[model samples]
Target: MRMHEHPTINYPEYHWPAGKRCAVVFSLDLDAESPFLWLHRGQQVQQLGEIEQRRFGPRQGLARVVRLFAEYGIRGSFYVPGVVAQTYPGLLPFLLEGGHEIAHHGYYHERIEAIPVAQAEDYLVMAQELFCTQTGLSGLGHRAPSWEMTSDFLQTLERRGVSYDSSLMGFDHPYHVGNMVEVPVQWTVDDALYFRYTNSPRDKTHPANPGAVLDSWIEEFEGVRETGGLFMVTLHDWISGRSQRLRLLRKLIAHIRHDPQVWWARADEVAAWHAASPNRDLYRVPAHSINTHFESATRG
Candidate 1:
């Protein structure tokens, strides 16, 4: 199908009721390092063949994240890697019990853009089945690991019962990608920023300084709210599971909870709202060569 042939996706435009400003969606990436790193490096592959660190794994971190979300009375999406789900069967039930949504993050956490098209399709299918079987809930959302999704990957998701994908960045609101609505923008407020700022290199095992990250995020949130847009915060089990990070998350949640206009919701809930509401053309800019400052603040 051609790029613009798909139906336009319409999202809701609910005003803050008087004092409200913006909506927030928190998404967690549940991934295991062994298979994920192995697929990329032979050294990690050999190391994984020797060690078994299943106990202090993705599920453990997920449990912590879920607990934190429950404390805030908020529901978010948990995008799990298939390998992680198979390794930890108890994780899915805990998420379901907490009323969180389970989304697919791909099988084995392989980079779909690097793999062959047929192989990528197989990986996506495997992920969907493993997530459904273990969780007893079929996932409707997809997020490519490492934020690496090509056009082919998007097409594969459209074919695999995926209703939305949250891998795209630089868009302020959700938009249709072919026949699927993409929950665009990830890495807006992530632990990776700490690593980048510290020049610590990208290591998921490293802990994130949550207070500093949250402070920066709050600033971004205020900016988006003033402009009437969506704020997407991406967290990873391995990174945000630390005590310091969790504490920062709680503080951020407290601020969001006090605001009546700020809707703290799940990705699916936001998608459903968009589908049911009228299209307001929220992200369109009036002129060519849009200024980066305005685009950065309002683009989904």
Candidate 2:
């Protein structure tokens, strides 16, 4: 395998608004089987275990997670699919009540890279409209369904007036995906890799132990503190909402709270600060580079 040339985002010299040591962005994704549904449309009836596991999110996990945030008095960026917002009406309202940042996570969790451009446009447009209609708030951030970023997708976000995205793995700090700011995410800081399973024979899931995940994330935070880079954590309600894993998340937050220098921010605030950054241009991906990088990733 090969690697694409990563973004040359210079986080070392950039000054944070709070002057904190490093930034920690905790974003929770409420995909809730929408991606599975999109992938298995015709056979949706047969995937009972998948359906119930995902259903566990909205049914019990959401409120638990919301209350956990309240206990800590810190807000998370909640990215929900448009269909999810519609499917579970109370979930959005609860998030809004907690003063969390609500952002777009594709309408049905469809992979924009695999769909036609027009189809992708319609899916995003309807999702944006429907979510706004439901909540009366428009999204300022977007996280691609499968962490798949492309030129067309970035353009779509730019045209929609979205200020930032949290889908790419290019850089840890907030940087540009075209004119749109990207808050990078990594597999290491995510719980799904450790927890999610689909009963597939080839899928090698991580251990059921939550301490391993907790310990690894702390290491990441401490290491990023050196450069004062942003530490973006991607979590799923369905996977991380279980009792033990939720405890893991709580401990993670508690551990971070121990550090007085860590800046706790939502993704939008990070984007706003980065947008005003004098070194902003250093991270901007030129028009042609998006396609070039995507091609390289595909080939590699």
The candidate that achieves the highest lDDT relative to the unseen native structure: 2
For each candidate in turn, the TM-score is 0.78, 0.90
The lDDT, on a scale of 0 to 1, for candidate 1 is: 0.68
User: What does the lDDT read for residue 33 in candidate 1?
Assistant: 64
Q: What does candidate 1's lDDT look like per residue over 1-300, in tens digits?
A: 222322335544544323446668888877656344545565534544222333343636667877888777879888888777777777777788888888888777887777898998998888788877776666478888888777777777777778777887635666555555666664657654563221224444554456667788888888777766678888777667766677888888877777666877788776666555453234332112223343224546
Model 2, residue 297: C-alpha shift (Å): 21
Clashing pairs in 2: none
Quantify all predictions' global Cα lDDT against the true fold. Answer: 0.68, 0.81
**Candidate 1: residue 58 lDDT (0-100):** 63
Each candidate: RMSD? 7.4, 4.1
So what's the TM-score on candidate 1?
Answer: 0.78
lDDT minimum window of 10 residues, candidate 1: 283-292
Model 2 residue 237 CA deviation (Å) reads 0.9
